[model samples]
Target chain A: MLDKKLLEVLTSPPDAAVAIVTQGKDGPHVVNSWNSYAQITEDDKILFPAGRMNETEQNIQADNRVKITISNREVQGKSIKGTGFLVIGTAEFAAEGADYDTIKAKFPWARAALAIKVESAEQTL
Target chain B: MLDKKLLEVLTSPPDAAVAIVTQGKDGPHVVNSWNSYAQITEDDKILFPAGRMNETEQNIQADNRVKITISNREVQGKSIKGTGFLVIGTAEFAAEGADYDTIKAKFPWARAALAIKVESAEQTL
Candidate 1:
């Protein structure tokens, strides 16, 4: 189960880095962004807005496999330390629907919604 | 080319979080750490000490595809901001030799060295 601590870390301010690894033609390709948005789902899935993700979108479509990590200790002058996590999951895309609408609403530039079905999550020190 | 600004960021104090995403069996696996250690090679590869990374080591050996991100702003009460990067690369393991010895000398607990060969990199906001 996704605990409150994990939720807090995931929902932290935009300063936190979001790293997503995808299989590339040459090797493993990494796409990272200073994340300001991520919606946690009922099934523990994480939904991210896929905006301007030309290569990332293609990589995800080609291979749903992905490893995601969110970690940070700085934001708005407060040090909310001691919480980070690594999530392993399968990614699926949603072009239209309530989920897609919500994501687009949050990030106007969103081209689609990347929904990750959580397989496991581990705490990081 | 790797710039000085990026080097400063990558070599920043341990408050910054290092997130590494690797391909796993179920889908993708994420392994993260506070990362007080990393060696930047002449060819732009990033080396990290792999200690107690049972699953992560396994995953890397299986696929070698990965994405990595490092971001932070608060450490020792100083904020050095405006620098973050995403690196897409291939991962390889080295059990021993000069490269491995160098990593071991830096991190005593490190069992093996995980070297990531840089393929591409992009600045993150």
Candidate 2:
């Protein structure tokens, strides 16, 4: 079971650093950085920023089942780590939401974005 | 950076499900299961259970750096995921510590075990 505090951080409406590992022609490549979490629905759909030309977005388009690792740390000396399948069923530019103005106003660098449906979840220690 | 509560669960001495992705002779493989967390030192050393003949232990012995994903889900509609470098420096039987008796008494299936040193850490969403 996941600890209460760790879960809250993951489900909270904030940006988080997501590490995406994919099988490239060269080898296994990993990208580590911060991306804003725009929306997470009760049905397990998660929206995040993914520029058009990024390797992750491309890989997701080619392969639907991509492994994503999400994590958060707490001051109470604990941490939560979630590993699951990030099923990318759709992609679009972030110009169609109520928060679109806010996102565009703040993140002018994002060229494109994507919406991911989390098909399954498992708690990790 | 990590949220306060998430960090507490990771550093706590409870067991967690660690997804270890490794490069095998065949191809990239992943193992999803649960393991007990014995000790996490101030120097970023993390100890977990690994039998002598497990594929993960063998891979760690051959390769120093292994990708480990840890996760937790909360009742508050949040989750935390942590991805980091698990450096396996040492491996030993659990019969030489104060907690050894307890661990052995509880987990008789663990034929051998390992102590991992976490060299780096990253939070993911």
- The best candidate by DockQ is 1
Worst 10 residues of 2 chain B by lDDT: B71-80
Instruction: Give lDDT tens digits, candidate 2, residues A1-125.
Output: 33344345455433344445554443343444333344454444555555443766555555545444444332122233433222213333344663344445555655554455554444333
**B76 Cα displacement, candidate 2 (Å):** 30
Interface RMSD of each: 3.0, 6.4
Alpha-carbon TM-score of each model against the true structure: 0.71, 0.44
Q: List model 1 lDDT by residue over B68-103, tens digit each.
A: 776654322123354566777888878897668878
TM-score of chain B of each: 0.84, 0.57
Q: What does candidate 2's lDDT look like per residue over B56-124, in tens digits? A: 555555654555554333211123343322221333334356344444555575554444445455544
Q: Which residue runs of candidate 1 sit more than 4 Å off their true CA positions?
A: A24-27, A41-44, A73-83, B21-29, B41-45, B55-67, B72-83, B88-91, B95-98, B117-119
Pairs of residues clashing in candidate 1: none
